[model samples]
Target chain A: MLPVIEAGTGPFTQPPTINPAVTADWLVAFLQDEMRARRSVAKAVIGLSGGVDSAVTAFLCARALGPENVHAIRMPYKHSSPASLADAQLVTDALGIHQHTVEITGAVDGYLQLEPEADARRRGNVMARVRMVVLFDQSAKYAALPVGTGNKTERLLGYFTWHADDTPPINPIGDLYKSQVWELARYLGVPRELIEKAPSADLEADQTDESDLGITYARADAILSHMLEGYSNEQLAERGFTEHDVRLVRRRLDGTHWKRHLPTTAMLTNTAINEFYLRPVDF
Target chain B: MEPPVNLDHRAAPLRVAIVQSKPRKGRYEENLRELGEVFAQLTAAQPAPDLVILPEAALTGYFLEGAVYELALDARRFAADLARTWHEAAGGATVDIACGFFENAGGTYYNSAVYVEVEHGKHCVRHVHRKMFLPTYGVFDEERFLSRGRRLQTFETRFGTMALLICEDVWHAIMPTIAAVKGARVLIVPSAAPGRGIEEDDELGSIARWREILHATAAEHGVYLLYAGLAGFEGGKGMTGSSRVVGPRGRTIVQAPALGAHIVRATLDMREIDLARATLPLLGDLGAVLPDLLLDEELPLPRGLHASGH
Candidate 1:
């Protein structure tokens, strides 16, 4: 089935999500601010999943602070392969950050339904939220901040669960697209193999971002850039874009627009109807 | 090993006097006069004190002006005179006096204590200890005027192997631990602590309550911990007079009435220390786990003399 987009629908007309390039000196600074802004933040907490995002965020925090300041928690569910766990250990040992492991299979199974289960999306949200809860628990114990891992592409399409990826005090790569993250990772001296690995949510078996999205990251970046630059939908389609793809992208651009803003507040007084605007500092 | 000191095997309760009062600020003469009255009161009692403990900086209140001008002690002469007066009042009776005073020795001023024995209207001052730990935070400015003490002395008296420490001396783990390890049955602490700055939520009601936790240190280390603190306001600051007595088992056996200039006493058994240490052997485990910075031969001084700043 093909998705459709109505005319005059897109996130461009609304308020922007966080743009790290404008507000932050670097990705590390952004992440640090996020972590320390919370009352419960002790220090920086990382989960070295042997994935590029986690590894990159961990390294950035470690550099911004010190190796001692960065604490890592590795949570491996039942189906997590031995290789992934080994890779996680390798990354943590290499980074020299404090690390602890929690095998979560028993907990996960105890909660599983005996009947037919929910879809992958719901299950993924559950896993993400579970991991977040664990991160928060560990963070409280050490007085550390949980570092989140959700890139720009996932954020734009609302691919992440609201409370899961957003659970961290700091998100180092939240502003950069998947491809730009790749570029930054190379610049940051990340191991080439980890960076080259196909981007996966690792929530389900054999799930890859490119395969699920039905488009390459390079193509998605070009389209996003064009959309962000105020290029019309007609212009995007004219620039070697498919009819169904353009409509699908535009529908996504409209449907997830609410993710880009603070929730609505009711106007209560005179000059209060479109009169009260919140200051950034107040929030 | 045979018992080292000759003490009464049959325990006799002795009156313990704690001069829980601060010295008058910058008025050494007035403070000495006030101390004279306290001494007179203690001596006039039906059963006079077997021992009297005075607070750290008892003669000269927490002196701040000395650090600025480099003249800390004008009270040593006054302290000597006061000692003579107290000796005369005691009427040739041997009274073990832990008198805290500002000691000016070899052109260096120190916050010190003197254990004097009053005999025949003359004084025989024997054991002397300067404060080892000099606090440099909050309200305290000990390091500004006074130099750190290099010794932890345990004096043999008519009582027992009575170990002595000044205010901040008891805060460090090793100081009291070493004193206990060296077979001190009684730990005497003379403190000049000001108690006015306690906030509403400050965990303990007063700083004295926090200091009282030293009872646990005494219990764990198997020693009797006694605190004698200043009571009145001095230099516009409220001095804490919550003096206390703890047994070898870390229990508050007796606590003096809070914020008052008074004397209190308790009967202690020296044998209880060995019994407690035998039951709960925490000190042995701590000894094995902790590195002895004082015992490092590569370092400058010998074991007891090495603790300069804590």
Candidate 2:
């Protein structure tokens, strides 16, 4: 069951809600159709992070492509919490999907050794990219398509590592906000422990996503949704949102526009890939 | 093209099959094969449908952008191909198909729908309705790629006088009114509406909005409205597939599921148009005042004219 957030209560109170059942059915069909739109890819390879986003994605994939065809790759670093790995295992076991554990501490440290002066942000980026490397390799090894786990909130706020978590060719939940992902996760019967846990990239010790982003997913999602609807900052403040949180979300959203799109290409002709010579991904 | 058999005074019901199809993007032959399978299933039914309707861009998936030029087929060739497929599946069975496709007319490309009558191994192009309104806002960019159609007219079918309105055409109020005024007893709307807005309960906001349009148009014109919607995904955008048939009384006769490929069947009694119109008399009233309304439109307004003056 999902919480019913009433409208006109407060700024963080009216995050967009979804019909989880309809969303799940639509996404399952989407996964099946898009996975085989261009080719005959029947299997999906997902990086299981034990978080609501990835867990919800895994459940959808298991339903779209049969559990036997879904490959859940759990790549954990040395400093990653043991609880995260356990939760991921619980999801795989419940779904009866194939699971692979690849410890990324060695691979991440192999590149970070030369950058001893790198900060936590840089180190986390390296770990995220390394996990992606393992994920893509496993996808190739298993002959399965890599499915992205990034949600719309992270994509809009630029919370994800560019070219790492957002590199997959297709994403089932990319359009869903993080708050919506939680609602879907609950609807999909994800483990209660995982759903109740604080969301984290698990790149470092005690680093929750809210603390790093300076705003909760619930609050940020509401602000982002309203802003996308053309709500002004003053209007948002009038609607009971704190000025500080609104500024933080807007700044992150505006500054990371590049992360949401492909790399800039210098246009020299009448037709350019994606810019002028446009074709839908399925096309 | 052979002329349709006159059935203006016929009181028999028209059996309609609305195929909520999911066309593989850029794969015309594959979609044709799949449609053949659907035709075969329909042929096996005890009471075969007189007409089968497919969603907008049923042969080539929606959201084609520049690829519309590549996938578009001339009306004659498209009708012939459909005739061949129908002949292979149903043999001597005769069925009318109203399907949306990218059309190549001379050198211009248009988002068009064709109403073709297929029998045995032959096909006739009853009418071709190029989409008048090419939506260009939000996720849509049809106007940028395909040329807009210029005419809005109804034609004779085996069932009676009918009109075809593509997805966005029905969104405008005047389109359906004009079709009704032009003596369309039934309105066929083939759509490729993308699922959007999750705020509504148990239904997508877009689908709910479409239902409003369908019900209002059907009730207002006292005409049977058949809407066939495209199902499946194109670049993550899911086309909502709640294809439906609305009777003249504004009640849904039958509807497909919200997603995936499914066919919905409905038997429409053409006499219901007369019955409903006799009860409401709205279309009759509109027709009576239409000439006066047009004369009013032709005359220029006086200076400083206002509603108070009127």
Candidate 3:
């Protein structure tokens, strides 16, 4: 959901991704040093979503750490789109990485049976969490760490299930928005079908992110960014958005603020974790 | 050691390699491979050249019309790749490379020369000279596609102080003059000029005109001039390949035969620039004649030069 500047020359405006030269150098340096120092391993494991986000992440990982040092895992449920599996295989084959297809049908269904009255959203969350379990297990066996595929637009919108897609040791694509992901996907040489496919959580049949959100990511990202810059509710409506939609988004923004932060503890001690203890993500 | 263009050893001498290449019109990747092969050959030579010059639009051929922009190079990624190829082929030898291509700059297409220097597998683009004079008559319609360059400046490289100008930029004396004034010891023209007219010597029209300008510029400025020309036939436009290196005394050191691929090399004496200027004092007196100072004050034209404004 980022504004595409200078877009007419190609499908993308300017690629929102980092410059190829700078990115290649930094990522390679970062991955090699961090793997040796922090993880004591030389490999990375990534769950492949049939989406641009994961493909791009995997592509960079392959470049930073050689394809031999990267493992691609595809965890699909019975209801997962067949195209997603094909796309995951496409990336793994292209990068020549070690590939594993772990079907989470049994694990997801086992959790779903305990709460048979759960809606599609609740069941989808279970499937996502189950896939994470499979990914982490593969990571440990391969002496690698799972790579996060969730992007900024999804994170900003609270589109991902907590502790599922969000829980990863490394996430290079998280800071990029959905629209920016398309630009990077093109630059990274990800499959066109994967980039162009309608983005979906694949929780239920015929469920698209835009259709569920009731707003296009293109418009929503622009508004969200403007809002974050302290655009008033009136200003946002003036720009574009019905009063109703603005109210819905504003309320969601207020409601989801907690999701963006680490869990807060009761301030019963001399110092809070927020104030005293701070740990930066590495490795 | 320089890159592949040494005749003999001399103190502070600059060895220049001029590669006259024929680009497969609109094929950027193929041209790069060909350049890689040339670089491989150069790497094997004793006393490798200090500077390697490739023809104008060597990355993508000139006269591409509408598709030139589409073929306009992405210098960053392209340079990184070409640098790796050079390092691998050259066995990690460092060389300053000046070559031409259509550049995509701020959504505008520019006929440009990208000067790259690679050392130990790392590369840096030293200068990007967008074409200043875009011809728009006869077989030339560059202005239709290319955005004109705003500056005519020179840069310092590992070898020596140098300046790069695209094909038509050399046609206008002021462009080369500006570069000479900017402390450039070597004036480089990466050209895509086509051969014209039939002569007993095969050097006539465009080739002859180019030689005249190159010699005059080099002799006057006391600077070595390298003209790297494109040699190819694309859609009936035959590019003239009279790529040559002219000394400060207006002497032609080595020139590629017209309309053919060649690798011309010559060793330049840096002290000769001082010798020539000291003997002639023309470049020395350049400050009194014209110092590139701008004056907005309007002066009435001389009688015979123009019609009376009144």
TM-score of 2: 0.51
Q: Considering only N, C-alpha and C atoms within 3 Å, which residue pairs clash in candidate 1?
A: A34-A169, A35-A169, A42-A143, A42-A144, A43-A144, A43-A145, B21-B231
lDDT (tens digit, per residue) of candidate 2 on A210-247: 99899999889899987875566876786688999889
Per-residue lDDT of model 1, residues B1-310, tens digit only: 2323556622434456666665565666677777777777777765677777777767566645464234244344534565676765666665767866677777776777777666567655557778888888887777877788888878776667778888778878778888876667788888877665355474335674545567767878877787877667765677766677776778766666556666665545555565677768887777776566556678776455445554
Candidate achieving the largest lDDT? 2
Clashing residue pairs in candidate 3 are: B2-B48, B2-B49, B3-B48, B3-B49, B4-B48, B4-B49
Best-to-worst order by TM-score is 2, 3, 1
- How closely does chain A match the true chain A in each prediction, as TM-score? 0.80, 0.94, 0.86
Interface DockQ of each model? 0.01, 0.01, 0.00
Q: How well is candidate 1 docked (DockQ)?
A: 0.01
Q: TM-score for the second chain in candidate 3?
A: 0.89
Higher-scoring candidate on lDDT, 1 or 2? 2
Misplaced by over 4 Å in model 1 are: A1-283, B1-4, B7-14, B67-82, B196-209, B283-310
lDDT of 3: 0.77
> What are the fnat scores of the candidates, in the order listed?
0.00, 0.00, 0.00
**lDDT score of residue B211 within candidate 2:** 93
Worst 10 residues of 1 chain B by lDDT: B67-76
The lowest-lDDT stretch of 10 consecutive residues in candidate 3 chain A is A1-10
Off by over 4 Å in 2: A1-283, B297-310
Deviation (Å) of A33 in candidate 2? 58
Q: Give the alpha carbon lDDT tens digit for every residue of B1-310 in model 3.
A: 3333232322366778888888787888887887888888776777888788888888778878999878886667656766877887896788888888888876877888888888888888888788888989988888988889988878877556778988788888878777887778788889988767776375667788888899998988888888899988878878988888887778677788776677887767666676667667777677566733432224443444343544
Q: What is the total number of backbone clashes in candidate 3?
A: 6
